[model samples]
Target: MEGLDPRAFVLGCSAIGAGLAMIAGIGPGIGQGFAAGKGAEAVGRQPEARGTITSTMLLGCAVAESTGIYGLVVAMILLFANPLVGKIAG
Candidate 1:
């Protein structure tokens, strides 16, 4: 890496970091899906409680989705406004 440009290296590493940050989305997705499925099952078992179950499920899903949204925001920042790239003394 003797001839490697620092700015280019930082940019490349930021891209990789952005990709890894995106991986954080998978857990939230899976959790939200599972919560929805269980919520549906719960509502099916007690139709009268559908309103409560639905509302609770939606809230949980929203909370779970926030993590994925955060990951997406981090990835976007890394890709678009990468602070590390500016730190390189080019």
Candidate 2:
């Protein structure tokens, strides 16, 4: 590690972190898909309640999406704000 260039190492780690962070998207995708399925089923069983079911499903999807959004923020920070690089220089 001592032989490695600091900027290169930081960038490499940032790439890895960005990749890992993107994995967070999987949870929201799965949750939203499941919610959509359940919503469809509920709507099928009670056509009159479609409005309520759809709204509830949308809310759940939004809540689930927060995790993915956080992951995106982390990735962006790692890529752009990379405090590690500055600390290494100082």
Candidate 3:
């Protein structure tokens, strides 16, 4: 780290932070998968309410996916439009 310039260090850390941000995606992935499985199970038990169950499951999945989208946005900003590099370096 001593040999690295401030810009390089900031950029490297920003990249790592971006990578860490993407870890938030795992939660939504797992939540959606669980919701899908439960939806399937519910449908199997109540075939008559398939439409209702499907809609609810989709809504839940959409809500769950928002966190992943936020993570992606944060990662993208860090990777492509990092303001910290300039602030810390300049």
Q: Judged by TM-score, which candidate is best?
A: 2
User: Which residue ranges in model 2 land beyond 4 Å of their true spot?
Assistant: 1-3
Candidate 3 residue runs with Cα over 4 Å from true position: 1-3
Residues 1-90, candidate 1: write the lDDT tens digits.
Answer: 799998888888899999999999899989999999999899889999999999999999999999899999999999998988778774
Local distance difference test, each candidate: 0.93, 0.91, 0.95
TM-score ranking from best candidate downward = 2, 1, 3
Q: Which ten residues in a row have the lowest lDDT in candidate 2?
A: 81-90
Tens-digit per-residue lDDT, 5-73, candidate 2: 888888898889988999999999999999999999999999999889999999999999999999999
Off by over 4 Å in 1: none
Clashing pairs in 2: none
Angstrom error of the Cα, residue 32, model 3: value is 0.7
Query: How many clashing pairs in candidate 1?
Result: 0
Q: What's the best-to-worst order under lDDT? A: 3, 1, 2
Better of 2 and 3 by lDDT: 3
